[model samples]
Target: DVKVTQSSRYLVKRTGEKVFLECVQDMDHENMFWYRQDPGLGLRLIYFSYDVKMKEKGDIPEGYSVSREKKERFSLILESASTNQTSMYLCASSWDRGGQYFGPGTRLTVT
Candidate 1:
């Protein structure tokens, strides 16, 4: 089965601190995504990369950035973490149109 693994299951950060979240998929899928899930808000796309070294920002990418230098790994960086950025972050990947497969999640708390 395909799987996605995130660096941390939960994180605690302070305002204005820099943060990094990492994700890796073993399925060798070409498409990967990062999103934040909030209560009643569902998944809001932050960024997605279709291929290695190529990426595109999604609906909400203001406070976040991503890197995808290799095919199996993608990293997300928060230049300056904020309370509003404290949300459940998800990593997902898929092949072609099979639909996104998700990681368990990373719950970030910022104060």
Candidate 2:
């Protein structure tokens, strides 16, 4: 069975603050992704990592970065959070061509 967990279910941050969102997957999947969900824009990919220490920028990568130093853990970093950046962040892991397992989303609010 695959299980994904996020460090926080809800988070609040001030403008310009550095924020970190952590995700962990137990399945040892090779692919991990970070995405943010908004009302109208839907899910926007922020970054993805194919393997340890190997990351690629997704659809919306500006002001954000990612780390995958360990196979089971992936982290999303917000360099400087802004109000517009507030959204529900999701983490997912999967094998090549396999269905992705997603963690409980972390709702982030930047004021």
Best by lDDT: 2
For candidate 2, write residues 1-111 as lDDT tens digits. 789999999999999999999999999899999999988988899999999999999999999999999999999999999998889999999999969899999999999
Q: Candidate 1 on 26-99: residue-level lDDT in tens?
A: 99999999999999999999999999989999999998999999999988999999999989999999888868
**Model 2 accuracy (lDDT, Cα):** 0.96
Worst 10 residues of 2 by lDDT: 36-45
RMSD, every candidate, angstroms: 0.7, 0.6
Per-model TM against the reference: 0.97, 0.97
The list of candidate 2 runs beyond 4 A from truth reads none
Q: How does residue 81 of candidate 1 score in lDDT?
A: 97
Worst 10 residues of 1 by lDDT: 92-101
Model 2 steric clash pairs: none
